[model samples]
Target: MSSTATAAPAKKRGSGLFQGLQKVGRSLQLPIAVLPAAGILLRLGQPDVFGPKGLGWDKVASVFATAGGAVFDNLPMLFCIGVAIGFAKKADGSTALAALVGFLVYSNVLKAFPVTDAVVNTTANKGVDVAATYNNPGVLGGIIMGLLAAVLWQKYHRTKLVDWLGFFNGRRLVPIIMAFVGTVMGVFFGLIWEPIGEGISNFGEWMTGLGAAGAGLFGLINRALIPVGMHQFVNTVSWFQLGDFKDATGAVVHGDLNRFFAGDPTAGQFMSGFFPIMMFGLPAAAIAIAHAARPERRKAVMGMMVSLALTSFVTGVTEPIEFSFMFIAPVLYAIHAVLTALSMAITWALGVHAGFTFSAGFIDYALNWNLATKPWLIIPIGLVFAAIYYTLFRFAITKFNLTTPGREPEEEIEDITKA
Candidate 1:
């Protein structure tokens, strides 16, 4: 009667919710795929690990920084393009074009709202001032617009207009719908963007206010939700601008990564803790999992296990190892989460602020090294956690007889001889 037994059926029963969520998760890949380059460039622009801090490194680093900043700055547009393409039922150019059209409609309409001001300002030539305050609405806004565009594209792409107006039928008709959809969206957000933005910012502030405990909680939630693939949504708040930070520079930063690069003193509240887990802890788990395999299977599984460990350690991708035991033994995963939470708390308390361009792999760790408060601290923390993860995973897997991958029941295997 373990919850793990019901997880699959429960997912199937909630097919609508799960499928849509799965699609959103899948759509995220495109935008995320581009992040590593940006992160590397940003790191290159920062003062080197051995050099002094501040803008001095900008001369050489500026090229890379600006290159990377464009991606960070225009995340919304990228999401619109990425998600529209991802969610489109068919690979058609119209869907992508329509997404852009939708984005422009929302951007332009929201800017010119409160008609009197738009008109008066235009006449008085104070429109520039009005434009100055226009909020870009960032990634969250982009996701919404992208989803809306894809839905419209899917629904309208095949529509046929009356023969008299047939020229605007089929693919041509989608953009027309998106234009209206975008305006409606624009008008909708124009009135309430402030409250919505403020609410999210407040939620971020609340999370950050709890300090190390908040980070620990996030770590637990992050690992806990991986079974459902919904952790990314939770992470979106911290990685992007779920929280708002207004800095001394009179500029505003919304997310952990954004605030960190913006030179906000409190940047990396959510990200700093993951380095230990990704670069070391998970790899150790991989090793333990491999070692716990029956000796015969151990040799067979070692190559795969080693690759998973290296991938997680080098690039911070953990799905391979996480999937190894996520379902067959939920208890182990729960323990893993608890360990992750502890790691988060420890690192956060120690004030290690290294953030990542991609995952908390060695690459990002090295890149964000100089940008942190005590980046060197993660090295020792990660090393210690590796031993902890190895010992804990080995002991628990053996004690509970958890069926992690190569150690699965023999009868469960598909035999080619029988087939």
Candidate 2:
């Protein structure tokens, strides 16, 4: 009885942890979803695109750039609000208000007590040496505070107070509580970061120094995590805070995506490798799977596979193709992970630097072309990968008799037909 009881609780704990993490991942998507629009505007406004020199829409392009820049510049604020809304039970305005209040308090406290020695002379700061004044805790901090606010709200939003203190009961109390909590959090982070700043900087340097091998490892792990739906955790760090770059205006940006948009010359290691796989390799694999289907099922499979292939090629949504074979033919998925890693490493070796705000689809590839290094080379490389994927997938499906997609058992197909 004791063993069973203990086992049940343990299982519950594990399940709860997984669900919480998945919630965090879903919450992160709310803010990330806004980036595509921002990216399109920013790219369109580039001087070589629709800006002064290219399309001669100087003032209009500047307006577009400025509007897009507003979103990027305030990403941390948006993240906090988004995370709070995502986590709230009711997802109401109160949660967002508390998140904003917490963020403001935390930022102001950091401004008063800087954590790093990095100084800036931006118009916003006016030559302040306070590291926390401008973009201190950053998106990571915003995420933390947002999570904290949500938890605090969940815990206290329904509490009843003594009659004397009734005015601060329930939902109205969240922001008030977060103000104090944010102050404490701000001071704590500031104290900790003073000694840890060098460590963080060194870690960033180490990640950048890993080069192709690092990107390859990231790609492999990224694909492996898809089955469990946990790739977002790995993605957030690499895309948001992996490397650092200083822009032409002397402002620093972090992460592959941010740096790429800021025109950092060496910011696409984590992103360039995806284009070939999404736009070519996976589509070819889908065709291979369709051809490998039973003669009777080939027609049905082709219709479904064609849509999946086009989705991957145009939007870079590979889950449809990957999931179709992942469960029935696990070996194919394993090979895909390895292939993704190889793609990342190969792209790095070829000095291909490209990026996408959403995914490495045809749209992003074309939109970011002017900013990419060796962008045209992706075509020949993609064609080669297409052939490789098709050949290897066809050979594997035939050799192992892997039941991919339409290759299900005759009994199962008959059952579906009867139903």
Candidate 3:
């Protein structure tokens, strides 16, 4: 009967969803944190930066390559631990430990059982080989195990066992349950992952086939999904070995980034487009944010803008600028996405072939410059996008009076929260 009664449930639901996102974000934070180091290491080891592939810096590159690859190769393990810790109510590390155990078991199970035509075949899919050895599901599987282990921890951390099994109680029981669940998940993956892998391969093929157009489309979809945090799934699928790649040494690499690292001849199509956007476009957007701020807050906004701009340029972290206007000016966000797609398409068409361990940024661009087909092209492309971003974002913010970051009214608080 009351307005409060009608609105209270809705408010609770909203808060509940926000909290869930916070948890997921926390889980991803640690695993994502390691990427910068991994990227830097991989870049350091690449012979292109030092000399020619056959004779240049083999010893130096080998050391860093192995060190860096360790992180990328073990991303699933990191994801499992991070997500488990993230989802835990207590966040006491118990869930993380359990998740690690479960993920290991699950990965081993997949390895042991492998794949079969009977298990993987879909009548419609003909090109994919069913007998091919599949890599462990990696981060995808890690996220699943982490979530499951978190549940086991939540239920059994305080659980009391029967008289005969009194020792297997509370924290002790968490691992017990996860061990079985992990093995079951492994079997489940064995049965289903190949078909799913084939599907992802097809998707990657379709994107590559579209060339610049597909890159633009991919850019748009990636940005669209950011609000829900599901963007990571799409990103991982594209960045990792989802499609097949046989390197020069006869090593089959999977995913765009992985293939690039493995010396796959195909080139980094999905990855080439982002360099301009992350290293230049987002920074330009940051500048526009500062310029759009009211005169009174211009100093503060500029300070914020400078920091975020530097971050975007160096590390490809664009959230500080993205979140500032994503909600207030959905139209501008739409435009941003479209422009991002265009950048990807354009650069891709120009035959750029660089890949990054973390994101499209100065570190990856500069360090792997020699590895690319035309690394010099990235600089001009970046400059063009920077100018484009500044012009478009500045005009939109002022013309529409969009409330971005420091431009928000005093009474309206921007929620910096994200998952």
Number of the predicted model whose lDDT against the real structure is largest: 2
**lDDT tens readout by residue for model 2, 353-390:** 99998899999999999999999888988998999999
What TM-score goes with each of the models?
0.87, 0.91, 0.83
Ranking by TM-score: 2, 1, 3
In angstroms, how far off is 346's CA in candidate 3?
1.1
Q: Summarize candidate 3's per-residue lDDT along 1-419 as a digit string, tens digits.
A: 86666544346657777767656755776677787798778777777653356458778788887788888778888878887887778768677778888988888888766443233556656644355465456667888898889877888799988989988878888887888998899999987887777777787788778888877777888888786666765676677646677665454556777777777656588788889999998898889889888888899999989999999899788887788888879988888888888888898888878887777888778766766778788889999999999999999889988888778776553344321
Question: lDDT score, residue 329, model 2?
Answer: 90
lDDT of 1 at 176: 86
True-vs-predicted CA distance for residue 92, candidate 1, Å: 2.8
Name the better of 2 and 3 by lDDT: 2
| Candidate 1 residue-wise lDDT, 1-419, digit = tens | 87666454444567897888878877877777888888776666656621246656556776776777788777788888888888778747898889999988987888865423423346467564442455546788888998988888888888998999999997898888889988998888888787777787788888999999999999999888889877877777678866666655455667888778767667777888888998899898889988999887898788898999999988998899898888887887888899899889899999877677788888887666666789899889999999998998899899989888677777765563367
Which runs of model 3 end up more than 4 angstroms from their true locations? Answer: 1-26, 49-57, 115-135, 248-251, 405-419
- By summed lDDT, the worst window of 10 consecutive residues in model 2 runs over 128-137
